[model samples]
Target chain A: DAGVTQSPTHLIKTRGQQVTLRCSPKSGHDTVSWYQQALGQGPQFIFQYYEEEERQRGNFPDRFSGHQFPNYSSELNVNALLLGDSALYLCASSLVAVSGNTIYFGEGSWLTVV
Target chain B: AQSVAQPEDQVNVAEGNPLTVKCTYSVSGNPYLFWYVQYPNRGLQFLLKYITGDNLVKGSYGFEAEFNKSQTSFHLKKPSALVSDSALYFCAVRESLEDFQKLVFGTGTRLLVSP
Candidate 1:
C-alpha cells in the first residue's frame, strides 16, 4: 500500500517566477487535496480535486491553481510567486466515502522563493 | 465555517509520564475532528479522528483522543510518553455535512518528551 508521494522535494525560485509541484495519490485513493504550510503556521487549504475536476477551493488568489489527472496524480502551480509563497506544499489523498474518510499526506515539497 | 484551536504552543513531559494536548473547535453543524503529528521536514501523519461513535477514539502509536461534545473539545492523550513522540501536533475539523472537502486546522502544538 503506497502512500501519497510528492516530487521535487525541494526547489528554489525567484520572485515573479512560477513553480509546479507534483503529487501521486496513495494507492487506491482517488481524491487529492493541496495545502500550504508557512513557517510557524498550520497547513492552509489550497484546493481539492476529484474526478479530474476541482471540487472545492480555498481563499487563495488566481496565482494558485491545480490540475488532477485521470490517474489521480495532481500538480499544484503557482504563477508570479512571491517571497511569501516560500513554504511547504503538502498533498493529501483519501477515498470519497460516506464517512470516516481519513486523509493521508505525503512528505511535502519545500518551495523557497527569493 | 469550521475552525480549530490548539491553545498550548508547546508541552513538556517526562518520557514515562502521561501527556495531553488540548484542542477546541467550532462549526455550524456537527464536526469531524482529526489529530495529526508532524516531524521536521515531513508531512502531517494522521493520528486519530472523531467522526461519530464513542467519545474515546484510539489511533496509531498508542495515541487516543477524547471528544467532548458539550465543551466542543477534543484533546489528544497518551498513557505514557516516549522521547520519539516529540513533534508538532495539529488539530483539525470540518463540518460533517457542510463543505466536507475543506479541513480547518489549528496553529499546532509542539510536544517535547524528555528521557
Candidate 2:
C-alpha cells in the first residue's frame, strides 16, 4: 500500500558532475516517468520508462537519462549538470495500460547544482 | 504540440469561500485532462481527471473539475475552501494519438486560503 518513494531527499552537485536519483514505484504499477520542477514553475516531463526501456521522452537533452527495472523501480541520471539543472526531480508511476493519463508521484528529490 | 494554460499566477480567498482555478488546453485529438496539487517540497498529487464522461468530474480532497470540450477548458473548483487547501495547482493535457503518452503541463497557479 505504499505510495511512490524516492531516495536522496536532497542532493548537491557541481557543474559537469553527474548525479543519480532513485525511485520505487507504488505497488502494482508498471511504468515510471521522470519530471523536473524548477522554482516557481510546474513540473516538466523528462522521460518515461516501460518494459525496461525508455519509451517516451520530452524536450530534454541527452544529458538526462532514465532506466526502469524489472521490479518497476526507476532511476534518473543527469550528467554534466549545470546550475540551471537545480530543481526538484519527481518520479511518477502508473500502469502501462492506463495510457499515462493518470499518474502517481513521489515526494521528489531536490537537486542543487552549483 | 500539446500544451496547457493556467492563466492565474496566484489566487486568494477566505476560508469557507468557494474557489476556482482556470485552465485551458490545446491538443490534436481527444484530450485527456488532469488536475494536480503540489504542496511545498512535495510531489504533485492527483486531484481529478476528465477522460470521456460527464463534464463534471469529482476527485479526492473534495476537489472537482468541469471539462468543457468546446472551450478546451478544465477548471477546478471547491465548494468550501479550507486553509489547508492552499497549494500550487497544475493543469495537464495529453493527446490520444501521441505515442509517448506525455503530459504537457501549464505554468501552475498558486492558491492561498486565508482564515
Candidate 3:
C-alpha cells in the first residue's frame, strides 16, 4: 500500500506570491493536517481537515489555508508569502477513530521565498 | 496549552550501547505522548505513542518509551543502538481531553550513534 505522498517536493516563490502544496494521505486514512517546520525548529501545526471541513487551526495567519477533498487528499495554500514563509511544509494523515490517532506524514514540500 | 520539551540538543552513543532521549510535557488533562524519528531530509516517522493502558510502549525498530505520569516525562529508549539510528528524534504531546488539540513538538534531539 502507498504511504502519504506530496507533490512539488521543492519550490521557489518570490515574496508577495502564492504557493500551493499538495498531499495524498496514506491508504485508508481520512483526516489531513498541515504543519510548518522552520529551520532548526520543530513543526508547528497550521490546520487540520476532516470531512472536507477545517476542524482545527493553529496560530497561523489568515494567509494560510487548506482544503481536504473527498478522496482524502489535501492542499495547503499560502498567499502573500514572506521571507519567513520559507520552510518545510509537512502534510500528515491519520484515522480519527484510532485510539491515539497516530499520524503518518509525507516527505514534505520545501518552500523557499525569495 | 500543551507543550513538550527535549532538553538535549544532541546526544552521542556507540553502536551496540544503550541509548536514552529525555522528554517532558505539560498539558491540562491527560497527555497523549508520542515519539517520532526523522532522517536528514524526510518527514517525521511515528515510532510509538502512549494513549493509555501501558506506561511502557514498544514501537518499531526496537524502540520503546516509558511514560511517567507524575514526572510528566516520556523518555525514548533502545537496548542496542545502531549506526543507522543516528537521526533526529522528536517528542510530542497532546491533551487527552474531549476537545481536539494539535500535537506540540519539541525542538528535537539529534542522536549520533558511532560505529
Compare the candidates by TM-score and give the number of the best one: 1
Question: Where does candidate 1 stray beyond 4 Å?
Answer: none
What lDDT does the true structure give each of the candidates?
0.94, 0.90, 0.92
lDDT by residue (B1-28, candidate 1, tens digit) is 7889999999999999999999999998
Q: Could you tell me which 10 consecutive residues in candidate 2 chain B have the lowest summed lDDT?
A: B94-103
- Listed in order, the DockQ scores are 0.77, 0.65, 0.68
lDDT of 3 at B30: 88
- Where is model 3 chain B poorest over a 10-residue stretch in terms of lDDT? B94-103
- By lDDT, the best candidate is 1
Candidate 3 lDDT score at position A4: 91
- Candidate 2 overall lDDT versus native: 0.90
Could you give the DockQ of candidate 1? 0.77
True contacts kept of each: 0.72, 0.64, 0.64
**Residue A3 miss distance in model 3 (angstroms):** 0.8
Q: What TM-score number comes out for model 2?
A: 0.96
